[model samples]
Target: MVLSMGIKVGITDTTFARVDMASVAVKKLNEMTSKVQIIRYTVPGMKDLPVACKKLIEEQGCEIVLALGMPGGKDKDKVCAHEASQGLMMAQLMTNKHIIEVFVHEDEAKDGKELDWLAKRRAVEHAENIYYMLFDQKYLEKQAGMGLREGFEDVGPAKR
Candidate 1:
């Protein structure tokens, strides 16, 4: 449905969950149309993501995007875990130009409150805003320094 609307949709299944479900969905969609970009899942604390992403881009030429957020949990460690995940994702995005977007899913709000929806929406909006702010000037400079301007030219205009 999202793809039909011309959205370049991608799915992200964090380490806490299995990507098999999303994989099936992507496969079904691919059978219908070849428009979606299904980047592989990310595992928390896994050291191989950067290398994996690089290989994916080099081999498959796929643009990587990450989903950052926490799953529903009531443990004391939940907050810390969520923060850590977000931090790691931020670092990865900052250092990797191949990672062009981050979609944050607030699974903790699965109860489906209106406020929760609003908050989740706002979080994603803020993340996109920050990404664009950094992407336009700083990221371009880095790419320019590396003489890879053409490589990142397809990255669309930052959301206003």
Candidate 2:
């Protein structure tokens, strides 16, 4: 759980909707720890996230990246989300760094209140994760005990 003082963390988000939540969270987290510097980048939409992340690492010398974008409730948004996720993963692999992708789809909630709640919650949660990723060996140890899996969610063991 140790990082050099003033470690660089890149925070990228889309200029769409209220994705500003991510920016706010990153700033708050930065203030809380004071051990990391927050580098901010903004893109027009979800599709631009990957490039932002890549530049942050390669150009900005960031150790970790937190990307936030909100996909509206449209067919195109869903498709774009998938494409963005792919790019994000690719960037991570190419750069040999961790990218915390946090996207809250517009359709995920029943109403505006829920949507707002989801977006803010996810943004803050990922920001906190950034801290853990850079400074918490105990948290990493516990994650390892959660049963690793090949695909996305750790669905535990097969239940016949």
Candidate 3:
């Protein structure tokens, strides 16, 4: 159901992220369609995303949310990321809404350039996914089980 304020899409990002992923997503969404009211919330770190997202949905009337983060390479960072992910999942369950977790680990890239590239690619792709999820379920259904990856190349369907 579309709200009178338009289709409200929330984006929550972390200050710890080296790249500006939220901007990329906003640009992608803007390019894909019009009349979408994008609500953005910036947090200090990944762990703070759940509350920010929840607030966007509950308080700001957002229909869907995108939680973008960048976890460090250390083991502790991984653990923190895991915890934050759990919170995001719980928020989804509690709100009965979709919160797309877009996380890019620092170690996923070999260099700064690759990290930037991954962040932009992931943000743009996931923004498209949001469009699909909100407006084109048939398209996603047709691509089901196709091993679609956000930051990296899609693996496609498995060999039969």
Candidate 4:
């Protein structure tokens, strides 16, 4: 559904997992701001996500897109991930909008419990990222150093 010239955010996710990352993001977004609207589309596989996202942007007029998915650590999964990433980038260029690709590979954690934690962590973190991207990008600029440096936390502007 096309929103009429407002802050409509699109969330496209694959059906690989039962987790609805869009709902997670929407919860976070609602807590902060009510100006933004959430539109969600669910596709079957990683390769199909870009097309859905393109439709969301071009047809539904979403201002920004957040794509979420989980790819396994197999060779086939890696190749498919690469192709999907390229298509997503192309979609971003075509729409001239930011598409935050939030993907958590299936092999990222050590076990089932850890995997669940990682998936939720990554999804929530990206949701926070979307909030910042839509509202306060200066916060994101500092968070760019989050994993790049050890113990890098945004403490806001420090006293001189």
Per-candidate TM vs. native?
0.34, 0.84, 0.96, 0.83
lDDT of 3 at 48: 99
Candidate 2 error regions (>4 Å): 1-5, 143-160
- Model 3 off-target regions past 4 Å? 1-3
Report the C-alpha lDDT of model 2 over 1-160, residue by residue, as the tens digit: 8756698999888888664776667766876698898888988998999999999999999999988888989898899999999999999999999998888888878888888877787777777778878899688678764554321235664455
Per-residue lDDT of 150 in model 3: 92
- 50-113, model 1: which lDDT tens digit per residue? 4444445555544444343334444544555555555545545654533433322335334546
Overall local distance difference test of candidate 3? 0.96
Q: What stretches of model 1 exceed 4 Å from their correct place?
A: 1-12, 18-21, 24-33, 42-61, 68-70, 75-77, 95-160
Question: How would you encode candidate 3's per-residue C-alpha lDDT over 1-160 as one tens digit per residue?
Answer: 7556569999999999999999999999999999689999999999999999999999999999999999999999999999999999999999999999999999999999999999999999999999999999999999999998998899988997
Candidate 4 per-residue lDDT, tens place, 1-160, comes to 8755448889899888545666776777777777787889999988998998999999888888888887888989989888989999999998898888877777766777766766666666777777888889998797663453111223554445
Better of 3 and 4 by TM-score: 3
Q: After the best TM-score superposition of candidate 4, give how far the Cα of residue 114 lies from its true spot, in angstroms.
A: 1.4
The candidate maximizing TM-score is 3
What's every prediction's RMSD, in angstroms? 11.6, 4.7, 2.1, 4.8
lDDT of 1 at 82: 55
Candidate 3 vs candidate 4, lDDT winner: 3
> Can you list the residue pairs that collide in candidate 4?
none
A best-first ranking of the candidates according to their TM-score comes to 3, 2, 4, 1
State in Å the error of residue 117, model 1. 13
